[model samples]
Target: MVTHINLKRCIGCQFCVQVCPRGCFEYDFEINKVKLVNPILCLKCRACELNCEGDAIRIEKPIFQNFFAQLI
Candidate 1:
């Protein structure tokens, strides 16, 4: 899964940072925005997107089978 953080709309709520079960989001003190810290840990769960009040995060759904094939 690929997650993108839109810094513009983010208000430093840290809600996304708190809700991600895999610890995917991190609070960046300098930018005051939540960032994707470990994308590979993401389970493609929409919890972040649903909890983000500012709608600042987006997740890209990957065609996993196709992606896996590229490694060969």
Candidate 2:
């Protein structure tokens, strides 16, 4: 799974930075916006996507992975 941030549409709200459980999102002072800094740390929890008001973040769901995860 991969997460994408549409900087062009981002409103710099920083909600994603606050909601991510794994500290995947970080605030960029130079850009005056939030950025996903640690993709590997992301838990695919959708907390950032659900809380983002700017609709700037997009995440690819781990569909097939979830099925395999159940079997493990």
Candidate 3:
């Protein structure tokens, strides 16, 4: 799941908004920034984090999930 978006680091490139599969992010035209609007719909795919050119998106996965993923 997405934990945060550092507004200071965000470049408003809309990469996160464009790459999110679940539509968890939206471009806020008023602010010219990306907003995390549907966080509950996030699939923990890391698409937003990977696509963010500004390195603004942060995803928080559980410790156990990380442990299990390393084993796979």
Best by TM-score: 1
For candidate 2, give the lDDT of residue 6.
92
In terms of TM-score, which candidate is stronger, 2 or 3?
A: 2
Clashes of 2: 0
For candidate 1, write residues 1-61 as lDDT tens digits: 5788889999999888888999988898998888788887788788988889899888876
Off by over 4 Å in 3: 62-72
The residue pairs in collision within model 3 are none
Task: Encode model 2's per-residue lDDT on 1-72: one tens digit a residue.
Answer: 778889987888999988887898889999888888888777778888888889999888655655454244
Which pairs clash in model 2?
Answer: none
Worst 10 residues of 2 by lDDT: 63-72
- Estimate the TM-score for candidate 1: 0.80
lDDT of each: 0.82, 0.83, 0.81
Q: Which is better, 1 or 3, measured by lDDT?
A: 1
TM-scores for the candidates = 0.80, 0.79, 0.78
lDDT of 2: 0.83
